[model samples]
Target: MRVLLVGAGGVGTAVTRIAARRSFLTHMVVADYDLARAEAAVAALGEQGTRFSARRLDASDQDAVRTALVDERCDVLLNATDPRFVMPLFEAALAAGTHYMDMAMSLSAPHATAPYEECGVKLGDEQFAQAAAWEASDRMALVGMGVEPGLSDVFARYAAEELFDEIEEIGVRDGANLTVEGYDFAPSFSIWTTIEECLNPPVVYEKDRGWFTTAPFSEPEVFEFPEGIGPVECVNVEHEEVLLIPRWVDARRVTFKYGLGDDFIAKLKTLHELGLDATAKVAVPGPDGPVQVSPRDVVAACLPDPATLGDRMTGKTCAGTWVKGTKDGSAREVYLYHVVDNEWSMREYGSQAVVWQTALNPVIALELMATGAWKGSGVLGPEALPPRPFLDLLGAYDSPWGLREER
Candidate 1:
């Protein structure tokens, strides 16, 4: 399978490393706005880089992306760019008649008046709205194929199909104990996305209440993560899983929470209070004169790029789904999770734990598409496909998942 990978950041670079070892990918074109970054990612592979090449392509240029897809004869376009570019990349793939996949979905907005109580343009709403067009073209646009929304959604489907007759709730709980060597505060993933998901009003799904919005960091709970990570305080965060899972899986409630401890939550709150999290352009003094810049971009620029922190990072990160339900007239509760140790991921793939974990699932999904093990059309989430094939493939990649019973 030939692929046009649209980012050269941490996750995109990790994807190259993982896909390099796999035999399914015949060729991959690593494209990014920065030519040097894209070249560096492919060049790092050495002999394994033979099947891969680098190109400079702006993700926001729809015509250019479409032309690249056709010029390279890529069967799929894997978007590793930030959420802001999802629409353009997605439309380009559709226009080029190629399959598309993204770790994060399109951007969202809060409801005008009832921002807390209601949801306006929820996550994946823009992508799903074009489902009919994709269906008509007989092509697929897989959104939210990253670790949490991707693997967690698959776990929910697995539980509903094999472990439970009726599910009460499916909550995605993400936690990490990883830290950098010197930085007092360092986000393990893209801070642009981190701010977008963390500070936005969280969404929750209930069978009766449907999907509604709540205050940011609402519904705090202490979730005890397995594999020595222990218990961490998790809180509601706007994530793709909450919006994607319910459309296919039956559940009374669905939610996504991150194990953001007090310091992290407090910092995010401060960024909100100071308007540092806003993405709108503001005139700021540049080297020459006044310049328009996004406050969030300035914040991201000041922090260390998460991709370069693999060598300094340590510990582990967990992404999983916790399900509560009934099976054969008996109550059941289980957490099916995938954990990646920073030491192991850094040693093996030269990628940090968080991005490496996020990078693998989409490649696995692509391999499935290549081998014809998983097939679908229109806009779909990870849950819409068969889960068993995906779960079995994880072991082949040397990253096995575990299940803990909490009953």
Candidate 2:
């Protein structure tokens, strides 16, 4: 199948690497606003064939995105770009009459202020506002198919279906316990996204009561993962699964947490306290008097690009769903986790685990979709589909995944 791959950032780069190796994806067009990066991504594959090609695309531009899809005759449009451009690319997909998939859900525009700043709203639902229209057209948009929200959501369903009878709560914990050698500060994924998700107030969902808000990094709890990542502080964050899972399963409490260490936490708080997260541009007195810049953008520009961290990054990132409830009248708790080593992942896919794990899932989901194993219309999260086949297919990658009984 011909696939239209957009954006060539770290995640996008990893997606390209994995897609190049997939036999089902015979043709791929790697498009990005930064044309050089797109071409570099294609070159990195080292494949000498017309199966892979590069093109320049302004995914945010409606006409550009639609033209690329239509011209390429892509069977599916895979959005590996920033969440901010999700709607435009999705609209383009619908306009091009192709199925679509995105690794993560959308974010309020980077420079958003006040209301949307809270990040406590149902971001996923709001992002794909045209779900009904997609449904009407019989096209599919798989949302939040990344590592944390994607696999964690599917693990929850697997627990509900195969492990638990009376489910009480499902908590998704993501820990990035890695070291980037020489860099003092580097994000494994999108720096813009990392800032936005952590800088805003977090959200949680409860049975009957519905959704409610919490402070960013509130209610810090330490969880010890199975692969000996040890106990790491996991603080609440506004993740899409917390909003999506409750719609399909009955649970009293659902939450998402990130293991951002004290240093990162302190630094983020400082950025917020200094108002560096603001999207609005301001004039700074420079050599020529007034120069305009967004403090947030300035901060992001100063940090190391996450894509460059693969070789230098060392350690593991463990993310999964921890389910606690009753099974056949016996109280039980099971942790379904995926652990990825930065070094190995970098060697194999030329991507760090954080990028490798998230980027790979959506490609696999597309494999299922193209092969007719996964069929659905409109927008959907991981739990909306059957978990068995997806997880079974995911096993082909041979990353470490297993269930642990903490009874």
Residues 1-407, candidate 2, lDDT per residue (tens digit)?
A: 89998988888888888877777777989999999999998898885435888999998898888988899999888888877788888888898889888877766322235432333345676656888988998988888888877888889888999898989999998886788888877877776787778976677788877777766889999888767688899898778788778877778999999899899999889888999977689999999899999888898899988888888888988889999999889999988988888888988887888888888788888888878888899888888888888889767766647888988
Give per-residue CA lDDT, model 1, range 58-77, as digits (tens).
99999999999999999999
For all predicted structures, in order, the TM-scores are 0.99, 0.94
Span of ten consecutive residues with least summed lDDT in model 1: 140-149
Alpha carbon lDDT at 196, candidate 2: 78
Q: In model 2, state the lDDT of residue 318.
A: 87
lDDT of 2: 0.83
Best by TM-score: 1
